[model samples]
Target: MEHTGVVHKIIVAGIGPGNPDYLVPAACKAIAGAKALVGGRRALAQYAASDGAGQHIMAVTRDIEAVMAFIQEELHERDVVVMVSGDPGYYSLLDAIKRKFPSECIRVIPGISAMQLAFARMNLPWHDARLVSFHGRQPERSALLYQKGAVMGMLTDAKFTSRTIPLILMECGWPGEAKLHICTRLSYDDEKVVTIRLREAENYPEAKNGILLVEG
Candidate 1:
């Protein structure tokens, strides 16, 4: 048989908000079939222990160019699964993947986002919410969202922890009396969700893995 190169494929999979139960069946199936997997170290840790044995897994390098290069090289032989922490489309790896690979060569499998879960916990509708990401950046536009009276949903990281959000809003002249709905370490054993005044948030102890629901 004359040898022709394999038609490499990539599945941009969202594994959900740090819980195995939240992982969709389709994503599980795609991951099981992948020859190579790529994502953040934490996300890979969760998947590697459960569904990633026998697959070549790679962590996203600090230099995005390196990560992209690895994927490009691997895709020449087999399919690669890029695991994103939440919904891949929301403030996630989707943009980078799309830029490197053509849309026709990639398939996206959606997962439950932390924002969706946080809203569900509050029993509030998010259709009208203004979504923002303070993952690695400051919440500069958050003030505008507050001024417009937009119900806001935000994804936060170590830099913009739960405690810091209130401080930023306070600096932005947001009223300290307004209520903040915060969900921290969601879907984990230590998950906590509470609605408290903006002023109270300044003293909160646990500030990691936080999602914020701020009423504008």
Candidate 2:
């Protein structure tokens, strides 16, 4: 619990989906001043400039142990900043890092999560909604949650997206009559929001870094 002289604490910051406007000032400042940056390939590309004068660790498909070791090494040399998509605390790598480091030796900077942006764009109230992410797990769970009429909000992957999600729902005996909202590339210039039913979504194209909102 005591973190004296532990200036090498891990800093987990969310950089939002893609829009710089949604990036918190504190997160931006941290990235701007960081001496080392660690994140997935997508996150690295979003904040490419941060690697100009710092060590950049692309954690694409790397094991969690590798990520933790990378962070540990960075902390020994300079101030390290781990950039994550959306809020770091939202099904991100922050938890794993925290488990390896003491709470007092970590700083978290929150950014606008994709779930919040998705609901906001749809003008829907999410207080009563259920949110889930298929980022690092099976998408089947999202389908099951959607069937329960929880106004499901999900972070989809390339392998499991709007196209595949609906198919899974149908196979799981979902009502098949719910409204589907595919919010893709949120907060970016190429943002797209497609509305369709469960059946129609089965044929929709897969999108990366997108959110699926299901309403009955």
Candidate 3:
């Protein structure tokens, strides 16, 4: 009974950005060997990700409970891989994964974040940058962007877009001279990056989803 009680670990692999080229070997290995796979549609779309051996748990806000239940049932059977976008450390599903499963039963494999890629695309260093997300969230902490020297990388959704973020910052007193880099569809063939001043954001093209970098 003691031998039978040993449960297989749940592997949480971070699938970087949108490109398969950024996937790390360890993450690929985990996905390839998974007996059960759980993640967003994009994450689960990998060729050998599910392999028809187990269930597909869609990692959406509405299906969270069902996803957890699916994972719990599969965790003890064999390899179970949970994929997340970017690194598990950032604004990803890692937090929910931790809440649903104990530390001992979970293992995280890191991958590149869009923020990291955005900074890279700008040919700038990001270790000193301030990162935040406005995706499906309110910009309540606008005060955090008040700093005079710190660079900022904001994840914007359709609602809080590149056009509005700059205005929001200016309303909060972030000066008009600050440089804004709109990095859209990063790592894709159609990926675009444009630089402008914070004041110019209103005139910039609308961005559905991407990072808006604020540099001093």
Candidate 4:
């Protein structure tokens, strides 16, 4: 779909995980200067105290249609900014939006993703790490990517916590012998990182948003 008409320009910016410091200056300026802002609840919360004047739209899920419709409306008469969690390119809503809008009219501002923060906290070199997300689907496929001596970065859901992932790995024949680093609520005040053996993780409780790093 070719979006030709000048609605407002859509500035898709990433607001980091949940920390303001991680928010890049350019992204902060874009958001603060925009006439309108749109994103999920978590994204909106990060800018709750901003003095900038902009309308906020918090979608429940990946309601691309609704978000696009809102974007179209904003483009008609104002400079619009959309906030996405982590980097917009990392399994985010950017691709869908870009599919509908022309590239010339859309600008993307990248931010620090949870995977980066997770690896940073663990002091692990992620150059060879494989990243995956189980946020809206089953993590079985993701588990298969975890091979011996390979580093795996995973985005997990509430139901699939630090512990649940090990169960999946065990079922997939992942040698019950790997180091597991589970980062939950990354970049947030209550953030916690737990390390355990793949077999021991099964006994842990569930967490909110999680990033699992498995290596052998």
Candidate 5:
């Protein structure tokens, strides 16, 4: 790829949970000097005035092609920063970005994931938990993960929530008596953490950013 007499650069930065407080110094430093910012709408809004000032802002949507085009255009002139929610290594845009740009030209700065925040808020060690994401997937696909008794961390979405997920797990063999730790809007001022049995989760509403802990 030809650049403006400069090596093409792309920084895949993990912006952490929604709150600015959770953003790590390394990621913050990279964003400070970014020429173009590509991330979800919420992330751009969070840093728009500070790190995103005078930078080309592009919201990543279902259109992956458009995002790649925008990044490429920016790369020809200057470095571009592609931000992802949570740790870039997790179920994020890191893999897609890697395929679009050369590995040598890309640098990744990891940040705290919502799941990590969820575990932290609940004061539970997470290494033993079976983690899953139902962001754009079906629970039935990961049927084997719903063991009768096990520690599980699930990253939920609008379609999948405490209202729906707990019942789905129960149908997949999880016991109704199992505890559900519903951690929502982590790292933000409005963050909420609640505990209830899996059977009683129907009363809770959906959360755009939430993690559900299914503890045995």
Candidate 6:
């Protein structure tokens, strides 16, 4: 839907692991020109300028309706940018945003996802990797994938942290001798990456955000 002659815009920008260096040029420019910024407190603090002139809205809840209303209200006046960590198209709020707003009203900018970086860090090509988001999802796998000797890249949240994921996989019939690579806080100052057997992953400490590279 058009906003009459106002021509307001909504940008769904991916900020990339909350690291300034990982911020793409387009995303950086979008934040600089944003009249209103919508994101979590940590993301805003990390990428946004301290003295920039923009109304910052904290989007901590899963209330898509509330976020949409705020964006629409802000768009009526000027352009609004919705900041999201990692790639917006990958298990992010992009789908909900698109559902709430019209195509003409939105612009999406991609960023380096942790999964992509994990593959890079491991010096592996990810063209054949099976991508999965275990965030807010129960661990499940297809029997066909198991038969094809697939490489899986999984995005992890608190509930499915690095340490607990291997246990879940073991229960799902995964072998204990499989190769497991855990990458946490990619591109950040305290980033950590470790390679271990699936059996050893149970003792590894968990991180708030991480990726698991599993090869069977």
Which 10-residue window of candidate 3 scores lowest in summed lDDT?
Answer: 47-56
The whole-model C-alpha lDDT of candidate 3 against the native structure comes to 0.81
When summed lDDT is taken over every stretch of 10 residues in candidate 6, the lowest stretch is 139-148
Q: Candidates 2 and 4: which is better by lDDT?
A: 4
lDDT of 4 at 161: 67
lDDT of each prediction vs. the true structure?
Answer: 0.80, 0.78, 0.81, 0.78, 0.82, 0.80
Model number with the top TM-score: 3
- Output the better candidate (2/6) by TM-score: 6
Per-residue lDDT tens digits of candidate 5, residues 1-216?
443454878899999987888899999988877778888988787765564457798999999989989998888778888889889998989898788777878889998999998888888898777888888876555643566557888887888877888878877778778988999878878888989888888766655547888887
lDDT of 4 by residue, 24-80 (tens): 998999977766778787666666446544455545365768878877777778867
lDDT tens digits, residue span 120-153, model 2: 9999999988777666577445346434556878
What is the lDDT for 81 in model 4? 85
Off by over 4 Å in 4: 5-8, 48-62, 139-146
Q: After superposition, how far is residue 184 of candidate 6 from its true place, in Å?
A: 0.9
Off by over 4 Å in 2: 1-5, 45-63, 139-149, 171-173, 206-209
- The TM-scores, one per candidate, come to 0.87, 0.82, 0.90, 0.88, 0.88, 0.89
Which residue pairs in candidate 5 have backbone atoms (N, alpha carbon, C) closer than 3 angstroms, thus clashing? none
Error of 5 at 153 (Å): 0.8
Per-residue lDDT tens digits for candidate 6, residues 113-181, read 888889999998999887887888865566314533768888888888878878877777778888999
Residue 41 error, candidate 1, Å: 2.5
Task: Select the stronger candidate by TM-score from 3 and 5.
Answer: 3
Error of 6 at 60 (Å): 4.0
Per-residue lDDT for 117 in model 1?
Answer: 91
